[model samples]
Target: MTVSELGLLNILPILILVVWACVLLLLDVFVFPKREQVTPLLSAVGLVVALIYTIPQFGQPKEAFNGMLVIDGFAVFLNVLVLISGLVAVALSYDYLNRMGMARGEYYVMMLFSISGIMLMTSAADLIVVFLALELLSIPLYILAAFGRPKMESEEAGIKYFLLGAFAGGFVLYGIALVYGATGQTGLTGIVEAASGGLENPVFLLVGAALILVGLGFKVAAVPFHMWTPDVYEGAPTSVTAFMAVGAKVGGFAALLRVFMIAFPSISVDITPVLWGLTAATLIVGNVLAVAQRNIKRLLAYSSISHAGFILMAFVTYGDASVRPEATAAVLFYMVAFAITSFGSWAVVIALEHAEDRGLELEDYAGLGRKRPALALAMAIFMFSFTGVPPTMGFAGKLYIFRAVIQGEYYGLAVLGVIVSVISAYYYLRVVVVMYMREGDPETHSEGWLNLTTAVTAVGTVVLFIFSAPLFDWAAQAVLRMF
Candidate 1:
């Protein structure tokens, strides 16, 4: 096939996701106004369809729109990861939404929109496309966080996210403009050529790169830029929080990888110091603050921030050499591991909360094992994974990332990562102890399927670990071809 024909094939996934999202929006607004909803089911189907379409595209390397977007192993790998996370999110939302009395069609619609943006982030080769895709993913999340309109906390979460998000957007746009001014181009390939020719304006390039990093730092919740994370995660609906933890992190990392790998390869050393500092600070701050939280959701919020720091370490190892394959693979693997664990953890939290009482406090989980052994066990599994315990997907992911860092001779960062993982174990295990060791109230009883997503997510955690090698191989191959 000709190059244009190849490019057209590569673009199919984005087209399919957009069309599916529009159809779901139409069905939700017109055909299902009075009905409870089938949007979640349909959203799952869409993800499955996307995944099926993506499988055939693996190992194919093609660039489209004058090198504005690329399809290859990396894009396909991350696309599959995003779609799987979306499917899991949809499944987890069913019971949680029903219990919250917010099981509307719009929630699913927003999810589809967010997934489309994630896919875009994976392939976008231009700065403008990156910013647009970032906004597309974030705007829906802002609304979803505050979907509980009457709740003060929900409203606060939504507004805070929106305001900060808008500021980040402006920063990203300005950065893009400055980079374009410096290199006379917005395309990744063009920027790389300019940087290579030694004719680009160094001052403008530096400033633009700084601004871009600042903007993306906010999205990934790095230290100093993570002030909004705790409150937003606490106040947002549990399902949305879970989605943000998994999907947002995946998308943010994808954008980070694309920008650094394609647009600013020469400055990896210059940027590495800044990223190292941010990663260390984020890891220490998130884990330390999490130890003080009485609320489960808030604790997980901080934990998610710390996890972002771990993922950022991969960027620290990124450089002009081919070593990025291992780093990129590590990032992708960790995201999948985190997605399943975080999704399952939030599912348990949502299942625990009911209409009369939203038991988000850590104390409320006392004796859960006695009342709901199955769920308690599931929660324990998620906690184990999050703590990087053995035989879980989380452990495997950490091994891959830390190995990459060590291979890159980033011994200090790798050591700090290990230390924080140890510190984090205390808090994650604390929840498990509360569930199994403490006693449940006589009045409390486990509700049926109010939050059954925990079981589903827990199963996914186990299965992911069992198949982790193949997944890692696929991700490694994908990143190798991308560069």
Candidate 2:
């Protein structure tokens, strides 16, 4: 297909976001006198516009850039999720950067760029596009992780994230090279077609897929590749950490679902065991290690890892044709649940965080129930959601995943997932206990945007549960084209 035949309209959302980000960056320097104030609002406008473009594309599947990118229900669903995440991050950052003495125009610009990359990743139909999109989304986050400049911990976080991210990128590139060598194709569809015909180098293809998994595993902070998460979350500005938790996980899983289910199903026999082990180990380590954390950021970081494991529970059944659609849908719905819960919890954290990172310890939350009842209640709701308690989206998401897992007959994993949820309650509930049971003076900052974000997410986390059936059904429809 020629460049003119690429049908660029299929990716209008991604194009608008990237173009708007570039324009925003330029306007920040020359047009805006107070970038800290103007940039976030404009950045949000960009995301909203991108989101507007995205909504119309739903159920309208097409290919762009010579079949390198696809616009489908799957892409549209994740694009909306990632864009909303970016908007929330912007809201979380509005007061935070100014308070931390780190206000700048480029922060939001970098975030916009990163978000566009995530949108691209969700639409990616080629391994080359996947690798490019991975780097595009990751590089900005590395800088943002250290946005609290000169703070030793923040600097360390940036360096650690960059080093590790670069190494992971190398893994993906090498994997692509090997896969291309094995099948003589870099496009996912082409590779799958080649595999269906019996590849000349099946072993290399298997190794390549494994390497790709390793790279994406790092992105999702799966066990054994999760060493950077706790420190990075603790040291980075809390707002950036919040966005990283959702955006990175969604992007990584988008690639995993696309590449594995679409391109590598032919090798499911070889890959399924590795995925099972990853799910089990991630669940065990993420929850077990979280139990010992006193720092809220680190605890949530580990919690994030464990949630990745929960999503992986459904993904582990990707090889089973009978179960794959529902499993994929479960993963998608769970990501939305996790995003809502994570943003709400982090908003509360941001509300209480003090300069020099003073209010970060678990003990700092004591007496919050007495002093800030609404905020404390919101936090409690988030904790319950994280623990998979009822009347919340997390429970609904987990129910979908568990049902899919059971359907796949991965009873052992389903049982392990249940056990880990029980284990997670020990740590997640500890926050609620500290908030309500203990007594101490607690200080909180209440910005309009922060409070609004908290309320919206807290309410959505619960309300979405009531409508989860339709939501899950939509997710099921989203993945139908990929297969």
Candidate 3:
């Protein structure tokens, strides 16, 4: 499609964000000093504007650039989630950066760029677009992960994340080439039509799909492809880790769902088992390893991985026409639930974190309830949410996932899912136990922005649970065109 044929209205949200990010960067350099904090405010304004553009595009799905980019309900739903995550990341980073003496305008710039990439991924209807968008989102995160100069671990995180991420990218690029060679199609809809019509050799198509899965698996931090998760999550600046935990996971799954569901549903026979194994391994490894973590960051990293497993379960039985919508909606709800609670938990981590390891270890959380009751209570709520306990969104998310799996006739997977969630409770509850039951003086920085984020997320966790019916209905509407 020609550039003129690609209507601007279909992509206004992405254009607004990318352009605003560039303008915000210039403003940070020429207008706002480091101490003035103008960049973050401007950054927030840019995100709000982008979100405004996004909401209007929700009711009608449009394909621009010859179907290379499509503005659909799925894209609209995920764009809202991605934009909200970007805003929350900024809020979480503000005070943490100040406390660690790592405040800088570039951080927000990179985040904006990354968020734009995430938005692009959700709307991409082609594999080439997916790969480019993946890189756009990932490179900024690699820089942010190692943004802390002069710290060995931080430097190490940058290098490790960069190298592994590059290798994963290579897998994706090669897979795309193979899939194209096999079917002579690069766009997801084209690929779907080609595969459905019966390719001469299905081997190439199947292998290429597996390779693509490997690449996206790395992005989502699925097991066997998840080696870098714990170290990077531990080594990176805390707020970056928090952002990566949610933003990266959500983006990865968004693309994964779109590409596989929209592009390769014809090969569901081969795909289902792969996702089943991925779901089982990720759930077991992430939760089991989290049980042994001494560092809170590492624990959450594993927790993030385990949550990926739950989301992946929705994909396991997605080939069943009857269950596909529920699977997709479950994923959407789970991502929302996980994102809010993840940030809330990280806010508590930032609140208690001291420079040079003053409040990082699990032991450091002792007596938090006795000291800062509100913060500790927020942390406790996040823990309950993570454990899939009642009166929280996490429970509702798990319930939806389990029901989907069961409806898909994967009863064994559903049962195992419950068992792992039960196992996860022990580790998640440990934080609350340390905060309330144990005794020690845990030093913390109580910045206004930080406290506000915590309370908002904590309240959101329980409040959303009460109103889950409407949320799920929204999610179901979002996937109306998936079939």
Candidate 1 structure quality by residue, lDDT tens digits, 366-430: 98889878888998999999989977888998999898888888899998999999999999999
Candidate 2: lDDT of 101?
88
What global local distance difference test value does model 1 have? Answer: 0.84
Best by TM-score: 2
RMSD of 3: 1.3
Candidate 1 TM-score over all chains jointly: 0.95
User: What C-alpha lDDT, on a 0 to 100 scale, does residue 285 get in candidate 1?
Assistant: 95
lDDT of 2 by residue, 397-439 (tens): 9999999999999999999999999999999999999999999
Off by over 4 Å in 3: 1-4
Q: Which scores better on lDDT, 2 or 3?
A: 2
* Candidates arranged by lDDT, highest first: 2, 3, 1
Q: After superposition, how far is residue 453 of candidate 2 from its true place, in Å?
A: 0.5
Most accurate candidate by lDDT: 2
Ranked by lDDT, the better of candidates 1 and 3 is 3
Candidate 2's error at 183, in angstroms? Answer: 0.3
